[model samples]
Target: MGTDKRTIAVRFFGGAGNYANVLERCFTYVLTDNPDEAALFEWVKSNTRATSDDGIRDRLRFLEAIGLLTVDEDRVALTERGIEWMADTEPKLLFDALAENVRGFETALEALLDEPKTDAELGAAIADEHPETGWSDPSGPAQHRGWLQSLGYVERSDGTNSLTDSGRDLARRLASDGPALERGKSYTQQELEAAFGTSFGSYIKGISPRTDDDGALSYVIVKAREDGPYGDDLEGDRFTYIGEGVPSKGDQSPTGANTALLEQAEGSTVPVYFFYQPADSSELRYEGLVAVVDARYVFDDDHNRMVYQFTMERLELDHPAEFETIAASVTDGGAASIETADGEESEPALTDDETEFTETQRRVRSGAFASRVKSAYNARCAICGTSRESPAGTVDIEAAHIYPKRDDGRDIVQNGLALCRLHHWAFDAGWLAVSDDYRILVADRPDLEGYEEFSRLEGEELTLPTTDERRPHATFLAAHRGLHGFEPAAER
Candidate 1:
């Protein structure tokens, strides 16, 4: 008759995280203190490792439902039944209730009293007591262990378990009661298959990679240059990248390569390595392991298909010296470059043209940043709109700093302007300059041979970065004017 009453709860809440474990601790804590709901939650937050806000709130409702307590807004007051429970409440009462339906709760806890056991060892013991119960399943055991920890009865470390102070007391009480052990019911494989749509076995998901002729996915390369976009986005711990569109060569479906990327991003330590390099020189910098936490689908007009926007969380990185070694092995990532504070030069990065730079304000200047910036400007010179492309991945123009870095300039988009080789040389030689109002101010140098092009830029507006952050700062222009000694047209 006693076991029949327990069976009812097991039928309903057995598979659910054990209810009695949290209930015993909640009742005992309340009897000792008349804490308000908020204050009591603070205590729970500090004391328990596995108890959640929803779990505690649900248990509070349960206590009130059973006439054990009365919850009045913020205040929690114990009823007479609750006071009696405080006098002699033990963990076994709840364990016995769960054991009736769950099959292995009582037996597993009892086995722990003898010695600390690994999960495999404990699961073996649970299987011996009730072979048909799902207690041996790690998915199920995690909940049982959480329940025990919530009750402050046991702790597990390094795959071994041991009883805590509360557990010892509970063990003594259960030993004296000498409860009878019997398998309440045997859960069969058919029942398991029916419960879940899939068969009662492991679901193996794998990496669906698109193999190149060389049989490897290309590394997602980042160009970290001093004058290009800094890795400021990654410093905050989360890194987001918008990869090139799907249907990447071999697959008929758009999601072919993207599917592999998503699988690689699953929980914990995913084996995806991100590398970084500076602009100009061919060197790579190893970043670290990252996992894909979220992915979004956005339409790409370039390929007329959807591209993947992956939000990644970084795990750990190799040491700085080791990263430098890794980066040096592979080069030609075509990122922008910049000079560090210590006079160290990194990859040549890129920046976006005025339209996009103004929107993102990204200032890091790596080869990648350079590529984006050049694309924004259509790879043309900002002053004269002239550019030439080379087959060896070299441009006829170079990104020039509005305010030279040698004079304490930063490699942000706003401070950079793409110029043809002739104009780049002229600007650096102070033969030409840009006014504060963005007008071109070619110096009056009659001695120069190509006077038509130099004279053409006198009133031309300089093309800008996409966003305000990437755009050149006013103070930088003022400094450049100081060096070249050119005033705005309006000032003249």
Candidate 2:
């Protein structure tokens, strides 16, 4: 009995149409036999009755165009890259066909090709490129192109065109390996510390993840270092709160005492740090202290740290009204009451027993505090308008002591404004002052030029806060001007 060529053709083409069978057979024959063009054509004609000479020639030319087959004169051979490509696509219809079905591999292949084509180019080529397959919706191919671009197999040049090289290599590797590669673990201690601008040892020790066994993905409890020692203690041994579970692997539930200690630490003002001694005797540490300045100030890694450090505090102060509004809404039902020394009821005072700084210390701290407040309010220097984009970007700015620390001017939030170094010096020297309504004033210094800019600002109002409640205290400003030997700027 004759070898069943029709059965072989049917087996290859079954669900796939004529074109797929032709391409697969061509690939299989070329790969196995290493034949030139004329020989390959002759072999195809002898083996398969459906392949016409003209049709065979056209397919070969198409393969050459798409870089599947290379030709030298009348001779044709698969290149080593082409052989690797064939191996990369093995059994013809399995992965490559599936990739084309899923849009993953096809997109990757398009990117690997030199001079990537645009969507229209790809759409036009799809019929010729995937000749055996018929697409009912163009969107499938279009979506595949997008998927390829996302996977880094194809890059868009200009705005409309796409191409790839690295993506092709990656796709091929992924297809051969069956898409089960594990993602690499997160940063080591040194790496995490470098990224976060704080010690990882301190952070992990302070906060425990909400889910004990699930790693640090959920809610966390802050550790209290100053609140005294933790764990059931009496003997001099340190009972590390590694987690709610066992010190060794086989243990499931954490000891009862450790759970109680963790529950006590949650939502407390005091920071918590966590230390874990692994079963392998390796130690892992993390810092749990989080400073809520502004989103800008909280650095996650090196790329974001510098920007955060420079702008976070300023952003926080500038939008104090917003923060206050948020705080009010959240704490409305549980507002802390304040009691004056004269036994009068009042709103919560800024200073209390729990406050970090004393009144005298707050006065001294006002100079630095004011600078930070100004930096946030102005978003840059108030004078000379020095901003992040300026050539001399780091021009020194100070938070001029509106009320002098020596005179007991309070370091409270309201008595501050952003000022450049020059303006700060001028203010300190009693060369300028602001009215209760925030108008700028020039001192009666004969040496000073007091140009149109300075004169214009004299009665012009400073930018007011979004919330009226946060307006600078007129009494505080008046007290500052009086102490500084300057009359207040007249109201606009």
Best by TM-score: 1
Window of ten residues with lowest summed lDDT in model 1: 5-14
Q: Best-fitting candidate, measured by lDDT?
A: 1
Model 2: lDDT to the true structure: 0.43
| Model 1 lDDT per residue over 3-101, tens place | 222111111122233445455566677767877887777766776653577776765665455456787657888887666656666554444434444
Candidate 2 accuracy as TM-score: 0.29
The lDDT values for all models are 0.51, 0.43
Residue lDDT tens for model 2, 182-289: 122223456544533444344454334333344422223333233222231111222223223222333323233333332222111111223232334332433222
Can you tell me which runs of candidate 1 are displaced by over 4 Å? 1-369, 450-452, 465-469
Q: Against the hidden reference, what TM-scores do the models get?
A: 0.30, 0.29
**Error of model 1, residue 319, in angstroms:** 6.7
What candidate 2 gets wrong by more than 4 Å, as runs, is: 1-386, 389-400, 448-457, 488-492
